[model samples]
Structure formats: structure tokens, C-alpha cells
Target: MTEFEHMLVNSFNTYIEENGIRAISYRLKQHRFTPQFLDVLVDSLNPDLYLGIECKSISVDKGANALYFSQHFTVDKNGIHQIERISNYLNKSGRRGFLAVELRLGTGHGREAYMIPWNELKKKYFDKDLKLTLQEIRSFPEIKREGKNYRVDPMEWERK
Candidate 1:
């Protein structure tokens, strides 16, 4: 994982811990198809916040072609499908889940981090639960470049 991806995982784990979640956990390069390889998993008796998280990072390449959602893992069809599968697993187990993308540019050009509801995903995409519409995720402020590094301020998703 890149520094940005590491930061995202740390930020998420910190948020969960600060918010009083028990059994906060995260993994990298893990197999999500199996129950044992979830990137992040929080087990809570509280229905409101019981969630599993999948984190993805976007890679930027210099080329004549313009940047498109399809070019990024977070916005690609496969990414969506992966999230949907996780969502379905959560729903079936009476829990909630999300696919969290840690964009390199933060909310670049007006994109944001969002907690797409499982129900909406199920309706739009089949029972697979891995696809997501652009409108599903919320955007955050853009990351600012500082020297050789980029900095992203802490952001929060508005409670629904």
C-alpha cells in the first residue's frame, strides 16, 4: 500500500476507535471473497454501525487521455461489484457494509467520500451488492501538496 492508502486505513481505524467501536480491525492484500480476508471489519451489537469496509486507492498516470472514472479502481465496474458482494454478505448477516475509496487527490474536482446505503446498491445493481453509482459516495476537500508530499485533512461523512 502507498502512504495515502496507509493513512486512509489509519484514519478510518482511528475514527472507529474514537467513536467507541469495539473490535476494530483492518488488513491489506487480503482475500475478500472469503470471510477471513476482509480489509476492515467491526463487530458491534448496535445495528446502526455494524459495518465492514473495503478500501481502494486510485493511481494517477500522465497521458494525453483525460482522467475518467473507469481509469480508477474506486470508480470502476469491478470495484462496484466487489462492494456489492460485501454489502450482500453484510445484509444477509444482518449487518451493514461499505466500500471506502481513499482517493489520492481527495475529493478531486468535486468528488467526495460517501457511505452508500446498502439498500440503494441492492436496488440498482442485482443482489451482488458490489456496484455503486457516482452519486453514492460523498466528496471531500482536495488534498493539498506540501513539498514532496500531499496532505489530506480529516473529513467526516454526514450522518443519515
Candidate 2:
């Protein structure tokens, strides 16, 4: 993982702790054969919440809306289809499943950071009963740009 990625994971871990959520963040290593596995796996990472997060950081250009770039990293049709297969395997064994994405700012002017719900993945890959609720979850904080790296404070972003 890159330095910025490390910061984002740390921020997420802090968020889980502050919310009193029982969660663990697993940093996935590059696998030559299994590159599709999530970069991070959050297991039971929230209090009464089971979620999986896939994080991406993008550098924004001047005068551009950061959200525009957020959509690029989402689970595409193929990815969603793959997720369904995984979900099915988990569900057949009676396991809960979820997917989320955290979009953080990288560098340049007008750069901003935020989290976007992978609603497409949830709606298409998961059962209606297994869908995640964004209202019940906490939001991540804006990442700070220092030179070429970005930083986020997990405690500051914790839900009230």
C-alpha cells in the first residue's frame, strides 16, 4: 500500500474504535493470481455492523468537483457480478456480506476527500435483506494534503 493508503486505513481504524464498533481492517497484499481481492477487508468492523471496504485515492485537478472522480473506482458490472458469486458463497453458508468505497483526495488544487457508498454494488450484488444502511454508518473525514501525501484523523471524523 502507498503512504496515502496507509493514512486512510489508519483513519478508518480510528473511526471504528471511536464509534465503539467491533471491527478489524485487513490490508490485502498484491497477489499475482488474485489481484481482484479487496485492498482492505473490514470484518465485523462496526458495532452490530458487518462491512467490507474498498478504498481508492485520486488526485483532483483545479476547479473540478472531486465527486466526479469518485465514480471511477466503483465496482463495474463485471465486478458486481463477481461480488455476487462471493456473496452467494458466503450466504449459502449463512454469512453476512457488504461492500463500501472510501474516496480520498490525492494532490493538486481543489483536491477534496470524501466517502461514497458503493450503492451500485450493494443494490446489484447483495440481497435486499442484506443491503447496507448509510444513515446508520459514520462518515470519513477529509484527508489533508501534506506535500504529496494525504492525512486523515479517524477520531475527528467519528459520528456524534
Candidate 3:
């Protein structure tokens, strides 16, 4: 992981602890072959609150207000969607699939994070297999970004 990615993950870990949430994050290296696996797994006493997160990070242009998430597909492969496949798995397993989006500022001063649920994302925003914008994601706030930081709240989960 790059230094920024490392910083995001570490900050997320600290957020998890401060919130008293039971969660664990797996490195991509361990699950590269299994694209259906999530980057982070969050479990709760209330089964309905479980979450599967796919962490994604990108640095936008200066003063950029929005970012996009393109559905994972390889041009070389006929039909392979690593990211969407993971989302499908999490949804089918009775866990909410989420994108842990990290927005890095162009100046490298700070970063913003948001957790967007997959159901809302895929159903309304995703155009076929293209991209979803940050504006659509910001509508729902499982974790809200404040001055480049987001504090995750388990209580904000959308009860399925």
C-alpha cells in the first residue's frame, strides 16, 4: 500500500475502535485470487448491521468536488467484474456492501472518506457498468466527511 493508503487504513482502524465496532480488514494480497472477498468485514451483535467494505482511493484534481467509481471490469477479459462480484456476494450473504471511498486532495494536505452502501449505489446511480459519482454517494451518510476525516457510525446502517 502507498503511504496514503496506509494512512487511510490506519485512520479507519482507529475510527472502528473508537466507535466500539467489531471489524477486521484484510489486505488485498491475501485475497487477490478471490475477488469476491471484501477488503473489510464488520460484524455486529445485530446481524442486520453487518457490513462488507471495498476500500477505494483516488486523488482528484485541485478543487475537484466529485469523484467516480467505475464498475470493475477488465477489457482483456470477456466478462469479469471483480468489484461488482464482491458487492453481489456481500448482498447475498445478508451483509450490506459498501465502498470505503477515500478522496485525496490534489494539494496532498488531507483526504476525505465516505462509506456508500452498494444497494443505493447500484440501483439508482450506476449507469449499466460505468461509474457512480461522489454527489450520489454523499446523499447517504453511514460515515460523513468532515474536514478530510469521516467518523463511521454503526448506528447509521440501513436496516435491510
Candidate 4:
């Protein structure tokens, strides 16, 4: 995982801890299909919630408050494939999958995040560039990013 990815995981774990939830995050070293490897995995106790989080970062020099969801592959692997892998793992494990994206603006001083659920993501509902505005994501109270932490609202999370 890159430094940004590591930071994202840390932020998420911190949020979980601060919320009085027993959750821990671990980063997967290997990116594979089977056996289910992901960028970050959050294991929660008490209520028994498991989340598979995938991290992606974009530089917004133009101050665009949007997240660019990529599906095509050039140098790196296709993001959709990765998302599917995580989604499959979540399905098999009876958990939920989320995508955590970081957008850094001018001078890297401004930063925003969007946490999109697998169901909303798989629809390919975004524009031609697969971009979602920050405001659009904020409307979903259940799934949203607070600072660098991509998290599900505790109120919206179902108890098991």
C-alpha cells in the first residue's frame, strides 16, 4: 500500500476507536483475486460489522470537489476488478464493502473524501468520467467520509 493508503486506514481505525467501537484495520500486502486480498479490512466486534475498504487518491489542482471513479486499466490494474474482488469477499463473508477516495486540492492544503457503498458504485451511475460531487456524497448519511476516514454512520449501521 502507498503512504496515502496507509494514512487512510489509520484515519478510519482512529474514527472507529474514537466512536467506542472495537474495530481494527489491517492492510493486505498482496493484491490477489482468490483468498480475498484488499487494500484495507476493518473488523468490528460488539455489533459484529465487517467492512472491506478500498483506497484511491486523486490530485485536484483545479479545486474540483469531486471523486473520479476509474474502471479502465492502463499501467495499474482495473479499479472495477478490484472493487469486484472486494465485493465478492464481502459477500462471501457476509459483510459490507466500501470505496474510500481522497481528493487533494491546490497546494495540497485542501482535502476531501467520499465513501461510496458497493451497491451505489456498481451501478456506474456517475457521469462519463465517473465523477461524483462532494455534495452528492454528503447526502448519503449512512456512507460518508469524515476527514480521511471513510466510515458508516453508527446510527445507520444495523446491529447483529
TM-score of each: 0.51, 0.47, 0.66, 0.64
Worst 10 residues of 4 by lDDT: 71-80
Compose the digit string of candidate 2's lDDT tens values, residues 22-78: 776567778665545455555673333344444544433323233222243345446
Residue runs of model 1 more than 4 Å from their true location after superposition: 1-5, 19-21, 28-37, 60-84, 106-112, 127-159
Point to the candidate with the largest TM-score.
Answer: 3
Candidate 1 per-residue C-alpha lDDT over 2-47 given as tens digits, one digit per residue, 9 for 90 to 100: 4544654565566667776664445546454633323555565766
The lowest-lDDT stretch of 10 consecutive residues in candidate 1 is 59-68
Query: Residue pairs in steric clash, candidate 4?
Result: none
Residues 1-160, candidate 3, lDDT per residue (tens digit)?
5453454455556766776667643345554454437666656555645667777766655544554443332322446455556656876888877766666666656666666777765654445534656665455564555555455564574645
Alpha carbon lDDT at 129, candidate 1? 41
Please count the clashing residue pairs in each candidate, in the order shown.
Answer: 13, 1, 0, 0
CA deviation > 4 Å runs, candidate 2: 18-21, 45-48, 62-111, 121-160
lDDT per residue (tens digit) for residues 2-74 in model 4: 7657766776676777887778877877745534355778787543447776666666676556665543211
Best by lDDT: 4
Over the full model, what C-alpha lDDT does candidate 1 score relative to the true structure?
0.46
lDDT of 1 at 76: 28
Q: Is candidate 1 or candidate 2 better by TM-score?
A: 1
lDDT of 2: 0.46
